[model samples]
Target: MTNLSPSDKALVPFVSVDHMMQLVHSIGVEPILIGLADYIEADFKRWELFDKTPRIASHSSEGVIELMPTSDGEVYGFKYVNGHPKNTKEGLQTVTAFGLLADVANGYPVLLSEMTLLTALRTAATSALVAKYLAPKGSTTMAMIGNGAQSEFQSLAMKAIVGIDTVRLYDTDRAATRKAARNLAGMGLKVVECDSAEASMEGAQIITTCTADKQYATILTDNMIGSGVHINAIGGDCPGKTELAPAILERSDIFVEFPPQTRVEGEIQQMAEDHPVTELWQVMSGTAKGRTSADQITLFDSVGFAIEDFSALRYVRDHIKGTKFYHDLDLLADPDDPRDLFGMLKRATPA
Candidate 1:
């Protein structure tokens, strides 16, 4: 078999968060969403093509930190992210993430990026993609619960993909709601800053929950959500964290990215062991139905899957062209003599 030398391997491209943001900005959010959805759908259709594993999570008293890794033969990718709800109170983001992409052929890194921004983008894109199948046609207004960094991206992606025009926002912190409202101003979206979650849901066709609390909190009750509403559940992705009450899940048809993992993380974790839930890949592949009736409430339980991060990294690597901004890390050692492993390490470093 042909092999690559150390110097040859260092030439592989690397991308930082700033570079990735430039890439996303230059490519634009709508196009990125479309491209990511296509990649995710294509991979989903060939579900067996991937080397998948459930994410590894490190739980703390206050929150959780997770590592999600996956591969699709040619590429290996992993994201490092933490969920600390109390961080915002300390002037820190609730979530801060970074990820890397490597060539599986030689196990060389192709890119390294801050996934804090990319996560928001990918999660919103995944939400809109699910809504494309489940939300009623001509859906305009959306009620956004827990306005934070993710809220703006979610609103934009929904507008681009599913034709949402109005966003009614609510958060325990008024400033958070105001931030979301301000971000959407003049973007052709009518923003309503509501006092409570129920007020935000008034006459909304779509309900998006992206709150960042780490406890088992109920953001949506049976009384707030009505028929024909598509719920993009983004925040309640951990075992002890839930945004919707048990009755809400019992009444709605649930859709998830990956059922086995979602069963432990998504709102379905609150349901019975045998409770029915549909995998989104099946819906995209036409093996399952999305919404049966206009009055049916549909929920997309989003726990941020590795496949989504895989797709996002792939998109950035492919489209973020012509920038030589990445560093060359000496992650591997090369040797002309395969048997001299120790000698190769000695030669890898400078004298």
Candidate 2:
């Protein structure tokens, strides 16, 4: 037996929660959000080059755990995420995730990262990116329903990417609304805490719903929504979980990330299986229409896609270079000889 050292291929860069926060603050949150949106938009432009599929989900009575994976012929990425709405009641996160990226050529991991914060950022960026295309021109105010862990990220992303200057917030829990308002106070946007969901929509051009219930519930009614407003519904992400009223879906021209997945997990699930929806990638690539008239209702039915997560992973991988925000983890078992893994383990043991 001899002493040996692992080579570069054995080391993978890892970004922890603390490192992720430092990276965001180092570049500024809004700028990070914008960068993420740019990466997502670029991927959508080349949407045909990547392998796409619905996230594999496991559902229990409490919530869901999902595996979202994708590859672009060269690199592969996947995220392990769980959504347990009841976790918040136990002083835990409603959602938490981690992800990995690998080189397709050799099947070696290049990066590993904590994705709970990244997911929030990417979700917000995706919403704002879609709004840039479908929202009515000159839209400045957004009605934000469900002021929970994701509220501030969504508001800041809209302000940074979509030019929204005002965010009117509402929540079933008044304390949550207050917390969001407090966090968003100095971020260059006018934060309004509303007593009711309807009050939050007053004079708002964009409405974003992001509640965290596992059951079917209507967070918005048909009469409550008027014309010319863009609805960014991101809360309903599983079967039997929805936010907007069926009448609202009937009245709006809906845009979605992936139709097969959205039809199973988004607001469109309430409608018929053949309900028409414009794939957002087609709109981004100029193959489909976005907002045709000022009076038209445009809805972005976002259910969080694997490609968007892949984009976020790519953004982090690119930005973390030459920075101390990541640590090299010896995640792979490498031996001098490819077939000597057992020998390497034996060498690692004390003689």
Candidate 3:
């Protein structure tokens, strides 16, 4: 028996939660959001080249767990995410995730990273990226209708990527709104804590809803929304969860990530299966229209797609180079002789 060290092929770069936070801090949150938006936009432009599908989801009364997978022919990526809205009552995270990227050529993992923080970042980036195309010109104020774990990230991403200078916040829970207000302090945005959702929407050009109830709840009604505003509805990510009334869907020119997935899991789930909706990728690639009129209502039914996660993973993989934000994880077995895995294991043991 002989001692042997794992080869480079056996090592996968892993970004832990702490390292992710540090990486974010080192690069600055807004800059990372901007970079992620660029990556996501770039991928969306090449949307035709990647494999796409609805995420595989297992639904339970409490929440849903899902696996979102996609590949760009060269690199493959997947994310394991869970959404348990009730977990917050027990002081746990309502949403948490991890993801991996692998080489499609040899099926070896290239990167593994905690996606809880990254999910929040990517979700916000995706929202802002869509808003950039759909939101009205000279849009500077946003009405953020949900103030929970994702509130601050959404606000910052909008400011960083979409150039929103003011954020009006509202939530059912006053404390949550206050928390978001406090967290958003000194972030170079005018933070206004509102008493009601309607008040929050006043003078807002972009309205983003991200409530976390696992039921058919209407956080925004049709009357609450006016013309010439872009609605970013991200909270409705499962079959039973939604944020806007169906009438709002009817009034707005809806945009979605993937029609199949958004129909099953996004705000459009409330609409008829044949209801007209534009695929966002097509809009990004200039094949379709986005916010054609200043007075038209544009709605982005965001359910958080696999391609966005793939983009985030790709961004992290590219930026983490020449930095200490990740560690080499020995996650694979490499035998000197490819067919001698058993012999390699035996050699690893002491006589």
Candidate 4:
């Protein structure tokens, strides 16, 4: 094990962006996405075992920064991420991130990784994983409302995890829709571009809203959402940002990751403080109902919880086992004498 190698035992394995992309291509993006979904599902099945809490966020006029942390007794993980929707106009990505995994016993980070791509991967995987529990049977098409950075990943993830074979892409920016359509063309999924958001949902069984706006915008009104469909509401992930009309939230059975967190950041932020919602982990664990009737609507109000990031970190820590997809970063100080901290520093000065 690189983590146990004698000379490199103090080094932490770091997966860079190039390494991450290489690893994705090596394992295939679809399979890795599926793997991430499986890991997330497994973690959800044992939700009670994790020490869960809301992610801490620092909001700004143009963006937000967040630290998501979680632990499952044996290991701990955390991610540092930011969301800046206006950055797109400034020729920057809307989101960027990095994550770390540590041994809870020693509190030493075992793996550090570039999670910008992994966040996109895990978000899509989580959406598809929830759909497996809530979506209509034999779901094949998805209406992707926002065709920005996450659109293609969401399309491919649904195809790999939830049997989605077609995606209808819509965005206010035609270039984004075209880009999403172009990206998915070679991913074995049929992509259709639509002029309006309503047109995108015409025949789709699953509808995903992933706009990056940081304000209250009704991407889907009550009249637009039909029954027997699963809605993945991802963009309404902050206090003032919401995608669905309040009436749609009222009619749908909502599932969320953490109530305290989602109540502040998800679509439920539009509802009452006492509004009831099912936890997705409970639904996955069979302790709560996901979808009971054929004509009922189900909503997975996703706010990018910490447990999902933890699961992604866990999966990457394991999958890079025998591969050359990571670098051992000399991040920790290893002294010959455990108590000789000053001596260790002095030894490296001139010798």
- C-alpha lDDT of all candidate models, in order: 0.84, 0.95, 0.95, 0.92
**Model 3 alpha-carbon drift over 4 Å, by segment:** 1-3
- Stretches of model 2 off by over 4 angstroms after superposition: none
Instruction: Show how many residue pairs clash in every candidate, following the order shown.
Output: 0, 0, 0, 0
Per-residue lDDT of model 4, residues 83-133, tens digit only: 898998889988999999999998888999999999999999999999989
lDDT of candidate model 4 versus the reference: 0.92
Question: Who is ahead in lDDT, 1 or 3?
Answer: 3
Residue 50 error for model 2, in Å? 0.9
Point out the worst 10-residue segment of candidate 1 by lDDT: 1-10
lDDT score at residue 50, model 4, on the 0-100 scale: 96
- Could you tell me how far off, in angstroms, the CA of residue 252 lies in candidate 1 after the best superposition? 0.2
Instruction: Extract clashing residue pairs from model 4.
Output: none
Q: What's model 3's lDDT at 12?
A: 99
Model 3, 13-39: lDDT tens per residue? 999999999999999999999999999
Q: In terms of lDDT, which candidate is stronger, 2 or 4?
A: 2
Please give the ranking of all candidate structures by lDDT, highest first, separated by commas: 2, 3, 4, 1
lDDT of 4 at 36: 100
TM-score of each: 0.92, 0.99, 0.98, 0.97
How many pairs of residues in model 3 come into backbone collision? 0
Which parts of model 4 have CA positions greater than 4 angstroms off? 1-7
